[model samples]
Target: MADLKQGSASHQHEAAAVIQKHFRRYQAQKRYKQQQSATSTIQQHASRFLARRQAARDNEQEQRAARFQAVMSRHHERIQQLELEKRAIKQLGAGELEAWQARREAAATTIQAHWRGSRQRQQLKLSHPALATLRPVACSSPQPADEPSCSTRPISSKVPSNHPLLHSVTAAGVTGLHAEPSTASVAAWPAHRAGLEQQPSSASVCSGVGYSSRAAAMHGALRGEASSCLSAEASRLSAVGAAAQQPADAPRRTAALPAARRMVLERQVQLRTDAFKAAPNALAAARATQQESDQRLVHLLEQHTAAAAERLKAAQRRQKLLQDAEALHSQLQQLPQLSQLPDNVTGAHFALPGACGARAQRSRQAHALALAEAKVGSKWWLPLKALNQQLRDAAAAAEQDAGSTSGSASKAAAGALWGAAGSTGLLQQDWQQQELMWKDSWQRIREEEQQRPGLQELMQQDQALRPHVVIEQELSSESSWHAASMQ
Candidate 1:
């Protein structure tokens, strides 16, 4: 009975173990079915949520589009209004009649002054030095009896035969029934004697022996009467005396007196003085005319400048107004238009596409799909974990078959990671080589620094960077491991 009982107990224990195993499998299956149902429900919910969100986004987009269209239309209208106002302002800017008149008057004044100055210069050049004495005076002073007639104009000394003054003076000088003076006789006057005795001098009294002493001698000789002849006579005495005693107020007389002769004589001294007096007045008048011309020119330049300035200011003002109008139009255009224009909405079109919120939704979808895929085969984390373990084992395994075929693909993927590990060893070798080279270079630099001023300071710079090499190596190895696991 005891043997039978023990056997039964063992059998019962085996049965119970079988039952527990079946129950655990059933529970796992049930859990899997529930997870699948939950996943389906989540997918359904996600699809509906995406549809709703897409519709809302589409609606918001439609509203935005409507607002944009309204804003553009209002902006265009405002631009038209501003254009009309600008045209009216332009009309008001025209018709400056007073300004035009001022410009014309100023131009005329400048032209007249320029002409006057030109005429004065021409007159100055044409008038001979001796003839300058004959110029008219605009004002006058009372004349003494001793003064030559102010009206007497100077004529050419060597008058041409056809000259009008020649005939008048010739007939007058010869009116008393005497032979006309020959040109040779007038020219025979001693030039050297004229030069020496031109001014009052003691030698002025001297005369040649055959010359008459007085005018009576010359008159008697001419009339064939000896009583009128004399050894010497004052040369041109009566002509000089008549010239000297002429009234300054006498009427204008066109005379043929030699200008050169009168210039050298004492007779026409008052005329020369009057000409000198008038010269300054003429020059002053010319200067005044020039000044007036300059003023007019400046005024015209100012007008032109003012006009240009006004145009620039107007352009700037217009530019500012246009900018302001554009900004306002943009603002007015941007004001919500969906609220203002609902009729523009078309048939059931999604206002916004799912693309707007696709990132989070797609991520959720991906998670769902990954979960389903994991149930069918293995979890993403399991494969990745296996792959990482295989790669690590392959990296460390001394026996070829330990991870050979098992992690071959994983090893290929982890080649960069293993290469980085190997590169760390290579980096250690490279660092050792670099350290040797640097030590030698540093010694050379130190020697050079000993010979050169300030080199020590340069070499000592960035002295804090030495320990970073170890830190970078550790970080690089850690990054490589993390990256390999992720892959």
Candidate 2:
């Protein structure tokens, strides 16, 4: 494998070039196919979009053409209607004036109703100039013939169609159509019309028309029609009545369109400033305060440091006292407690602060000094000192005298002292054993006092928890005989 790898390494660059060339060709072909597919997708989407847009445009054009056609048809129809109306008006007799009034009044009423309904549906008081344009209209529904109009216009008795009054009203249209009147009332036409108006309603009059009032008024000036003249006069009267009724300062219903409300927002910006910035001495005062605080802090820190040092010194003093006491206690153990010296056994003497043995914790190492004076006193301090003094003297005398008498004296005194010390050691051990036994008994008693309730108090558990069934039965002969015997 190593040889093959070594050989292949030499051709690595050439193989990589060939691999890269093929990969590049593959990538180019893939990219070309992808781009072509994407282009085809884009073309399909564009064509669909254009088709839809064109279809929409065509539909819109068709709808517009239909609406235009409808509008033109209506326009032509209205024109034809107006032309027919003109001819009809030219031929209208006095009776036909009522019909024209009815139609005009209906138009005005329709405009008012549309205005009112529009306002109500929108829930708004719309101020329209168009509302004021048509102030007068009347109903055309049937009314009883005996009833009177709201204006209290008197009704005249029915007159023949050929009545002279009719001829008088139609005089301008065609002359001599009536019997030659000896004398005619100039107001006959007006009185006749007023009574005819009263025949239409009791409570309401087919009052006047506001329907294309200008056009109606212009057409009323035709020279040949009596109905046209009356219509024009009626329109003039209605206008005068409307002007009288509406006050100049009448409050109008105004429209509240969402667009008309103010859309622009007003803004105001205010920056907060501090009076402290205006004062030149503020910084100086602040620095002085900070310096004062720092000084106070330094003073407090010094006090704390002194206090800490005192506490540490006190702790070290305590540790020194404990070490001294422990060392002296150990030295005292080596000294004989006898009142006299023994002849047989000599006591072991140790120098001051003798070995208390080495401890693994070296937190305090003052004991490294072997002969350093360590002060610790106990109840046996004097006795221990005296024993040490006697031993030193005995050794000195033995060295000086070198006689059998001196040696014998040292031995007797040391032996008696050590014997007493042995007696005292026996008492100490005995007391320690007794103390341990008492402590153990006390611990046992305390443990026995902690009673567990469940172990002792689970009485009548079965009868209290289990279900029971009543058994009705005769007593057995043996149980009855036992009960009789007990009684």
Which candidate leads the pack in TM-score?
A: 1
Q: Write the per-residue lDDT of candidate 2 for residues 1-487, one digit (tens) a residue.
A: 4434544563475466446456646755765696677767766766786799799999999999999999999999999999998898878886778887899999998989666545442321122221122222222444333221111211112224553333443453423322221212322444555765654321121123222332232222222222322443333334334444566776742222121111100000000011112223444555677699999999999999999999999999999999998788556444432223333322123323432422211111222111111112212133333443444454445535756656656555434433323332232244345445544654564464354223223224423432331111123334555676797
User: What tens-digit string does per-residue lDDT give for candidate 1 at 228-333?
Assistant: 1011112443344344457878675324345443442322233333334444556666677779999999999999999999999999999999999878855643
RMSD per prediction, one decimal?
A: 31.1, 47.2
lDDT of each: 0.47, 0.42
Candidate 1: worst-modelled 10 consecutive residues by lDDT: 225-234
Candidate 1's TM-score: 0.20
Give TM-scores for every candidate, taking all chains together and pairing residue i with residue i. Answer: 0.20, 0.19
